[model samples]
Target: MRRTRRDPIVTTVLTLLVGALLAGGWWALRSDPAAPAPAPAQAPPAAQREVTAQHSRQADRPVPRTFDRSAHSTTDPSSTWVIVNKSHPITPSQFRPELSIVRGYQVADPAAGPLTRLLDASDRQGLGFKIASAFRSYGYQDSVHKQLVAAQGEAAADRISARPGHSEHQTGLAVDIVTPADGRCDFEPCFAGTPGGRWLAGNAWRFGFVIRYTPENEERTGYSAEPWHLRYVGPALARELRETGAGSLEEYFGVPGGDYPPVP
Candidate 1:
């Protein structure tokens, strides 16, 4: 409808009133920050709804994948994941795994690659890790234990040495690492604080090895902390242990690991 004789003053007043209303609405919106805008009458598309649901499900944060504990044998002596401790012994006491030499140290072939990578990584980081001990035959271990016992007595020997059948070295999955730069700390607890030791403690999980015995876990491991002692359980279990914060294989696996059985 055209108003040919419209009043200019009245039109200006109406324009001002409309402008005032808009300004008031803008201020209201600005001032009420907590108030959400009105929702659309129509629902969002399925894909959009799904996206919103997914985002909202941070309450639905994707569940972390569960690790299969039985992916490898913990009881079989040859199994890469075998748990060897004072409470658990190699069944035959002379069990030997397929061997490979890494830097002149014999280790289970399954461990060779990861151990190699670990060593190489250490070298790259200037850690200069050396293998002080590796696979030991039952007889050798028995002799070693006897020597320690003779030197330091049974109680002291047991703290630092493993009985023949109960030794992880016999499993071919354990390696004693030392740093030539810090040779004085070889097989000593102070090694854990060394540059290489700190690096290995924090990074070895990436290569499937773990600082097997620790002071915090000594009661569970049945030995004093030997940061030099590394047991290969493969990268999978290593990552799981690192993630779950399990300090000892015995604690994680719930296997008995304290003190040797009383002699019959």
Candidate 2:
């Protein structure tokens, strides 16, 4: 009976010793500096997860569309984007556009409202622009060309004037501006150096107009720099030209210019 009691105590002691050893081993493992940290249980922050998902979704979507270049006909004489140069003459020399009066000058009917707005905006800025010339019929242009030839000789006249059939004025979309009050700066090239000229160069695009014969683009436009000459191509195209840095309609549309086409 004593032997059996002693054996039970021995067994209990052995069990306690084993449990202590196991517990001590676990502690030692946790204290070891080289031991790997347990994987974190908490998920990523909500904002971080959301941003990652957004980036993934954006990458899966197709690229957005770009500006439509074919929004208008570039070849049609009556088109707002028509690129008229020595090479691209209006088909019928006698073609006349519907006209409207804007600031005491005749311009295309489509152009009147924009012209008025342009003038008003400039006037608010205290830079008044007067329209000196607009909308020349083929017959009128013919007479002007003859007079210039008579006064300046044919070669000299060609430098400043477009042949009757090839003139943009015939389309009623071109205007010659002058600052009559800001020092008699009329049709002369010196007008470009004046305050009104500077304003027009920088702000005309906002009103659907461009200085058609610029010193930088004379080669492409087939005319000497005529800073006072403004051509109305509508706001959209004017904006595109300005944004894209296209110096002339010829460069924007890949149209050929710089010379009259050879006679057949």
Best lDDT among the predictions, by candidate number? 1
Off by over 4 Å in 1: 1-61
lDDT of 1 at 109: 91
Error of 1 at 6 (Å): 93
In the range 94-139, model 1's lDDT, one tens digit per residue, is: 8878999999999999899999999988889988889999999999
The TM-score measured for candidate 1 stands at 0.75
Model 1 accuracy (lDDT, Cα): 0.85
Q: What's the TM for model 2? A: 0.73
lDDT accuracy of residue 182 in candidate 1: 59
lDDT of each: 0.85, 0.82
> lDDT tens string, model 2, 126-197?
887788899999899889899999999987887778888789998888988887786566788898988889
Candidate 1 displacement at residue 123 in angstroms = 0.8
